[model samples]
Target: MKKLIINADDFGYSAGVNYGIIEAHKEGVLTSTTMMANMPGFEQALNLHEQYPDLGIGIHLALTTGKPVLSNLKTIIDVDGNFRNQAYYKGSFIIDEQEIYDEWKAQIEKILATGIKPTHVDTHHHANLFGDFNAIYLKLADEYHLPVRNNFTNTDSNRRTTDGFIYTMETVIQSSETLEKVFEEYNSVELMCHPAFIDKFLLNHSSYTYPRTEELELLTHPRIKTLFSNHKTIELTTFESI
Candidate 1:
């Protein structure tokens, strides 16, 4: 059977983002989301999860955004003490693998401490795929026995992931024809999206803004709901189920 998992990332970024994610899952085809442990809205995301028990949750691990959960990291942090930005990951700056592992472990543990069973693991800005971070990413997944978002570059025979991963937000959100093609092409796929109702925090912090509202509209549309629900071969699935 063809399975599709529509996962909204950055679940704990802000109240606007948290509300938008809940709306998408409740009113649209979204089946899962990943939370950022160190984000401002982390507590709100957990409370929202209590209200929507069936919305599968996962961890969106970070090395690029916000402050690290663990203190005194010599390698990953910038001079100002916040974690390095996305540009740092894209460049050739050296990172300590042990720091990556420890910080991520703390992130996972923080989520687990809240008594929420996370459904999977992924990275913010797909940062875990850079350099030796992929190995640590898979290692944590193995240690915790959680599934992961397939970036198509990192592979582990024992890891649990969908058959394919699809991105390119602008094209998918604007064109239902393109979304339909995605379902037709893969037996199982994870489509990553960031849907939000813009607020001051989101506006001030994130560069990829306005398009989120477009994604929210597309996701919650009745036609999009039918496209996923009534499709003959496509099954809406969650990482926990897969």
Candidate 2:
């Protein structure tokens, strides 16, 4: 049978986003979410985990766009501690993968130590696919025996662009096909997404935030319900449940 996993990303970016995700779980088809270990409202996510015991939570594995959990070196992060404003940057031929991996492990350890078992793992901004970082993520998933959303999605011709960020965004936009294909190709697969409202605040803070809201709209659409009507989908069996 075809299975579906409706995952919401950015569980701990802000209280507003956290509230939106929880409400989505209650009122929509959100079965899973990824938490940002280094975000401001992460504590709020932890509190929500305590209250909503059935919500399947996993690490978002953030290495871009937010503050870093580690303070050792400014390789993966800027001098201000926030991740470099861009995705996948290299400084003078140095990709900083080692620092990134070290911080990634630390973040994972911190999440596990929270007493909240992670149901699966995925990256915050698709940083897991950068250089050798993908192998590091896969190794961690294998070590924990947890699944991860490998976004091996195909890109349409219209998605091809000279701009890196826009091209990547379009790749993700065209990912439902990739997600479904992978679900059939592998057992117990995972897919990641960001869902939010296109409010003025989100619009002002981030350009991709609106696209994330668009994802939310699609995930909660009635057409998706019909598409999955013939299949049996699970709620991801949260770590909290076990």
| Winning candidate number (TM-score) | 1
Candidate 1 Cα errors over 4 Å, as ranges: 169-180, 183-185
Q: lDDT tens digits, residues 123-215, model 1?
A: 999987788788898889999999999995644566789878988754653454776677666677888999999999999888989999989
Local accuracy of candidate 2 as per-residue lDDT tens digits, 107-221: 8887888997887787866777665577777767777766566453424323211111111222322445644555555444334566775555455556676567666666566
Model 2, residue 176: C-alpha shift (Å): 14
Clashes of 2: 0
TM-score per candidate, in order?
0.94, 0.73
Worst 10 residues of 2 by lDDT: 159-168
Structure candidate 2, residue pairs in collision: none
lDDT of each: 0.87, 0.64
